[model samples]
Target: MQPAMRSLSPLTPSDYHAHGVCCCGTPLLQHFHERMMALFAGLHGPETVSASPRGQDSPLLLTNLRLFDGSGAPLRDNVAVRVMEGRIQAILPGDAEPEGAEMIDCGGRVLMPGLIDAHWHTTLAAITQAAAMTADVGYVHLVAAREAERTLMRGVTSVRDVGGPAFALKRAIDEGIVAGPRIFPAGAMISQTSGHGDFRMRHEVPRGATTPLTEQERQGVAAIADGEAEVLRRTREQLMLGASQVKLMAGGGVASTYDPLDSTQFTERELRAGVQAADDWGTYVMVHVYTPRGIQRALRAGVRSIEHGQLADEESVRMMAGEGAWWSLQPFLQDEDSNLYPDAARRESQRQVAEGTVRAYEMAQRFNVNTAWGTDILFNPQNTPNQLRHLAKLTRFYDPLTALAMATGRNGELLSLSGPRNPYPGTLGRIEPGALADLLVVDGDPSQNLDFLADPARHMRLIMKSGRIHKDRL
Candidate 1:
């Protein structure tokens, strides 16, 4: 179904220049309107897309606001944050409001760094039929723009995308032609035959003869290999495709029908070869591990992080720490409109996902494991609509501020982002000077009352990312 697009004038002169799409002037905006209309049709029904007032359309000053920097700390009230040139200039007490700066009174709302999604999949058209997309490059780029902006609307300004559908989505975001999070993409995930990511396979061949291999199937995925050389080669292949890091099917998963959760697919030699490939390129390798053997092997192989570690006990967790490994945990919280997975396999997958999350949480808390936070949603696009549901984990068990840190500063550290003093403008996750102005302002105090975390659409009144106003309810 085609989407409905609105034909409207540019909200501001700067918005026209900011897009860098059409040539300057009213005629250009008309062409832009037509292009956007075409983009809307590609995304689906017009209802899925929205045009937030751009550039000067968003008010500048957010005065008299309460703020939380996503660190576990006390909230500051009557504070003001100044954003200019896509970077945070200053953060000061309430009295520091700038004059003639389009003052937007935040009314004691709690402001924070814009949310980040640690692990996500936006490249696939549908998770089950993902392989079909290997044949499409143009359509994939067309869809990624809508997928990313949808993530932005959910208040996500950054993401660490674990592999799927290659690097097309990441390129679209970085090139400034689309709207989405600051994407750190791990291009393609490496997996052995019958491993977690090798979910399906097909071939076309002459009649009455053995099926012939299609080029797409060989290059797109199913990068199964048993030897160290092959593993190293495949890892390099992904890096060459513009991956920021590397992802491996370290073990089985609930999503892959072919792989068993506890079975180890790659040998220690092959795993280490993959890690060596990433390290040579100055990138980190993360593993999809749900069992002890996979976890142990990843640690032995010198991979940097582990995900979905359902079977990690005291021994496994300690080994990771000794090896300087990080863990990415998602708090699915089990009961948040989980009915979104109505199919039997998906429902079963949901159960496994929930169990894995809880187990991951318990291990992190008990062992004080070096960990980061993320919502491993987005496999289903519908899940994006209720993205705030994952925040309920903060309110229910952990404190909200700690939850926020897992989403923000901690992720920056995991991604190895440098401090404010770095020579080439490193990413600072805090609200201090030199931090990227990726911030969120809410209507209520989130520290004492965590439920404010759940209702993002209502409570988050202002959303700023790198000095850009994606959403403003002030």
Candidate 2:
């Protein structure tokens, strides 16, 4: 066990985040334009960033295609859609193609919103064939590009990256230096000296294998904050670093070797500080928690969401409802051969993470908490060839449509996107007039059946995001 270190920089709540309560409240959001002007240089580049510029139109249109509209609706065939400035400009019915618009026939396939994986690890990479057991910092960059390609090939148009050290890969992917989905990334996670992400030597680890989270690894992730002062500062730094949200270590995790599952690392004050910082920065904070003891403490502190709510009991679910907390309940799809790791403890922990995920989802649904789709897939596809297969197990609990909704519309809502962030209202995950032009043409109807999504390479007939054809037969 790692000895807990005392925090040196103590801070009171009143002095935190320019003094508490968050100036960026829901009501103050009406001043969105002014705030954007003031914060534009910081939010991203100096110029306001949007999907596309004005007036540029789609090069072609689709006609005679069966479309699903991303609403889990019955299919409509022989329709045409026009795109301009990366937004849907028109939708035509009765198989009518727009004049002078290059057209393609769909052969009666299903069209739906580009799937969003709410909680993917954007930085983790695949190990090479020769270095299966090697653990080094160099692997991080390599894994990021590999995973990005895999995700895009799977037809995922967007993803919310929960945690990664430094979040450098996320910026690279976003800058178009790498090919991947649009990423919403959280930088290095906030942790304490002896908390979940901290990987300092725990009583001299056995030879050959070092500590699960090394001090250098701490440099990338493992923001070790102590007391209210440092904790709040760390969270704010993450937000300033372009983190869409902040992730804190609220409890023990399977990835950490020293911490036990029941141990609660963050105090109420620290958690509250984290939340306050995110709120002040116009985003939210999500805590990595499992056991009820730790999750209960987080709920009391009023964080926005919970990640990997494994070991969460019925009471924890009720607490979520009482606090109106959102859940990133990633129901793990199980893989039979995931236990092939040589380290027995590591293998067991991975299995427990999967089981805990399923358990958490079941309880969250029972308590009626607002849940979003999250697929926290960490294992490399090479090692676990069933990477995509495992995710299928997650849908076992929900009807196919509900599962799709959790990943799409609900996920968009969690980001505060559609209405205020977006130029239009009720626009995403639907194909109504003025809705987004994110559509995927699949080989079959996913509303009536979902197995087709399991193998996107074989199933995704075409992928069109913002009317640009990223992948298509035409």
Candidate 3:
């Protein structure tokens, strides 16, 4: 389903100048300004040596390594990879050297494809809920900018951003004005009133015909719509905003305030409206849902991915497999990596999700479903460092190799559902010829011991995205 190519580049004013017209107050000018602000937002960090920019024309080689190609196969020794123009050119013998290439010695470390976070919130991961709701938009973007660099240093080279105002962040990273993972952005989360994405408080209920959108909605964190027409409009708006895929809230959520855990959201017709909108744009819809009824409704409406289906039953899981849907699961074990709750109801909801987490994984495996892994860390900066720890937690249900593959290759496969909207147009999530060069050199083999991933600051010796070295301590 590959469609015509689309540009991820920020808009320039050449058209206006060519036509002898002023570019003030134009969408292109606004977008250009957003990119500039995103670049300036990242200026708070301490000065350090930066790597020279490498584009499609750069020739680089990584040699002397044990390789885990992220294909779920056993590790291989004495292999080297040649990368040029930001993609893997060839896999050669460890001792083979080519002329006119910048070589990086791996020193017998483990070289593997860089990690991919299937369900991430680029603008919402690090900030607290209170800060996110009350802080200035520019301040929020600045915090997200610093977190983006930290996320890359954690060895996550790409992320499927399910929701938030990540368009500017993605543009800045793509332009090389800021350092971050390659972002496949789902512009905003669309939700019905009182649905999972709704952030309205008790006092703001009984919305009028012309009531203004909530603050969170205005910031692109979520969009609240009702009925088929409204849902279709909201879905198309996200697609028009450069969303690779669209996210809709099909059920209740723990982080949200009003919705109960058992509530089923978005009627079949409402969801179908969203599905039709995304499908027309050559992409698909992914929904945040966790109940049997919600899952069934979404699947019936042709949703391609189900996120956070921890509370699903066997029937729901079987239906998911039969429909060939992707299960984007997370390790919500209610331990160090989970977000803390202040109220009793939310805590009870957390316990239920934790209790169902392992069973959900087991069911997906039993049904042979297309399962992927992610760390849905939101509004918890302290737990964000435990992102890799969540991947390690997957070892409870699968072996180390299987767990690693879920985050690398399997997650990459799920991200490709964006089709034409895919910003970085190339193969990802595997160490093979013709794939994008997003890789990591680990101090130890994660295939044998997944614990190496839990401490990226110590074990991640080298990190590369698009064949350019982002962190090299080798």
Candidate 4:
């Protein structure tokens, strides 16, 4: 069952690093070659034991487990889940065993929906800031591929990528060429000149009408647009590039050097342009803004999601509640997971955001705003392992069950805002029949001991995404 062979040239590690395994330096073909080679060797070959069946279309039965359906419902016992064709087929009683199905005894563990990150930067999170700006885009994507595999191992099966050039990575994951979470990509973060998404040097200012786009912009990392027309064009370009949603910068950011934290970036007219473009394509716009003025302006222009509104005043929170907008909050507390900034100005801004995070959670709770959780870990490979710790930090504001539910069901709600542009289709973030098969079976009851999430390697007994088991310790 092998193909024709040829005398292949030998390559060194540095050759592999510089030119990649396939040498063309494209993630798709590189990953595809690796995956196909593995398959040709009998799915992990004669050396290691493959955990579970690689065929996603096969039927899978999980038995003897307590269920946290991610629906904010009470835990149920004595039930088994049936998965078929990458979707939940039924929730049967414990004694009902179907014929000709692969079964895994859960050993009385707890099964819950896999975690969903509402605000994530796929291609930008794991690499250092310096490397991301200067490294080869192909090399950057290879790093992202590794990070994406780690992300799945953390029990996160899906993410709403708010910014970054994640389209190619998404395609690789979808094609089974790589092991990663489902990505709902917003191709780029659109911003005006000197705004938050502008990662240009100070000497590169004074962009004339004929100035060429920066390297970042050319790579679909971020787009710098000035007026309404340009904003409209950029928004459509992202959609044309298979963006599930559009992300626009509406305020200053802590990471950017030129803009102050309180300065609003986009005007209402410009914001309206992006929103309308996304709306025409049956998707919504999510904006990056922190201050009240910026948040209110984005809401006035029909933005559906508000990202990082920690510094928002009570009035702005009220407006978000009135408009029924999704509040995508992240654990930005000045902790070990916080990004390191050398300058005092950025450090001061980080401190202010940390202080506002507590009050922002309180306001969202008080006003009944739809809140979702994420770990906006950027450019820090050392802190990337703290992704689950960020979710566990939600317990500081809510109980264990509530915090887990926020990462599962609540975040799933926010991702569904991308109406027809939803890439994976079917219901997600739930354990009922007809939902996508993304479940995690852990050692203990997370309802009582949320610490199980802090160490997924030893605690997670089994991990399944789209009816295919990626890891199995049972």
Candidate topping lDDT: 3
- Model 2, poorest ten-residue lDDT window? 40-49
After superposing candidate 3 on the true structure, give the runs of residues whose Cα lies further than 4 Å from its correct spot: 1-50, 54-56
**How would you encode candidate 3's per-residue C-alpha lDDT over 1-474 as one tens digit per residue?**
221121123223231123333457697876666555545434322212124444246677788899989888889998888999889999999877655677777899889999999999999999998999998999898889878888888899999999999999999788766678999999879999999898898899999998898998899999998999999999999998899999999999887688899899999999999999999999999999999999999999999999999999999999999999999999898886777789999999999999999899999999999999988889888877778888888888998888898889998899888999888888889999999999999987666678887898889987888887766677
lDDT of 2 by residue, 267-385 (tens): 99989999888777667778888888888899888787888777788888899988888888765534653434566776677677777777777777788897877666554555323
Model 4: weakest 10-residue lDDT segment is 40-49
lDDT of 4 at 381: 88
TM-scores, in order shown? Answer: 0.82, 0.76, 0.90, 0.90
Spell out the clash pairs found in candidate 3: 56-85
Q: Relative to the unseen true structure, what is the Cα RMSD of model 1?
A: 6.7
Report the lDDT tens digits of candidate 1 across residue range 220-276: 544555589878888888777767778888887655565655678788888999988
Superposed on all Cα atoms, model 3 deviates from the true structure by an RMSD in Å of: 7.3
Give per-residue CA lDDT, model 4, range 1-474, as digits (tens). Answer: 221121223322222233335676588877776654443222322111224443276677788899999976778999999889888999999876656566777899999999999888888999998898889887898888878878888899999998999999999889766678999999989999889999888778788879888999999889999999999999999999999999999999888788899999888999999999999999999999999999999999999999999999999999999999999998788987788889999999999999999999999999999999988888888977878989888888887888898999888888888899999887888999899999999887767758888888788877889987777677
Candidate 1 similarity to native, TM-score: 0.82
| Candidate 2 TM-score, C-alpha based | 0.76
N/CA/C clash count, model 2: 5
